[model samples]
Target: MENQQQTWIDLAIAAMDKAYVPYSNFPVGACLVSKSGKVYQGLNIENASFGLTNCAERTAFFKAISEGEQEFQYLVIAGHTPDPISPCGACRQVMVEFCEPTMPVLLVGDEGALKETTVGELLPYSFNGKDL
Candidate 1:
């Protein structure tokens, strides 16, 4: 992995440490880099209701968007799974809303295993605002 990717993975792991996972105990973290070079970190926050839980990827995107960072450069998601972690459907849709189709996304898993992909690759034929 490249140095910057490693750094993002490390940030995601650090963010994972702060996850609030009282139910499933599956902690996930995300690191998002904006076109302006700002970095945002987020972790999953579970709710007892289950349906109200917020994913780490969405948290990162929301945080950046709330702060007026629209254009994204990269995204990194970290988890303890056997393979690199994949974003949930909701998170993929959110990415399609705010991120460029070619924006890079990096998934980090156990032992620092990494998978490189793009937003469009993660959600093919996605539904976006243009379809509305």
Candidate 2:
């Protein structure tokens, strides 16, 4: 699976170059692989109002959903950090909307190292509307 993970890492690195981060300068990139074998990429976009910033993960998810894609297999998140970075709480919650709890999430660091995990493992008590 290293080869496949590398592919995603490459895509994410490419996407990071497209990020519009003028405020925080913290660019993040993400790529999601749909169940249909389609891949979607996203880059963090920031605004003067910090609250308006859109995370890389959500950008990918929103783009995929907008294209009528639903089912997802895994997602890769890349950042220019030494260690693999995890998604923020908001991004994790948004992922729960479209991804299965078992969906794999690969966090890639700038050193090309990877940390493999699942959405459920990241957000065990996710509120997926099952109780609502």
Report the alpha-carbon TM-score of model 2 versus the true structure: 0.96
For this target, which candidate reaches the highest TM-score against the unseen true structure?
1
Model 2 agreement with the true structure over 31-58: per-residue lDDT tens digits: 9999998999999999999899999999
Report how far off residue 26 is in candidate 2 (Å): 0.8
Clashing pairs in 2: none
Task: Indicate the residue-level lDDT of 97 in model 2.
Answer: 82
Candidate 1 residue lDDT tens string, 1-132? 378877888999999999999899999999999999899999999998999999999999999999999999999999999899999999999999998899999999998688999999999999999899
lDDT of 2: 0.91
RMSD of 1: 1.1
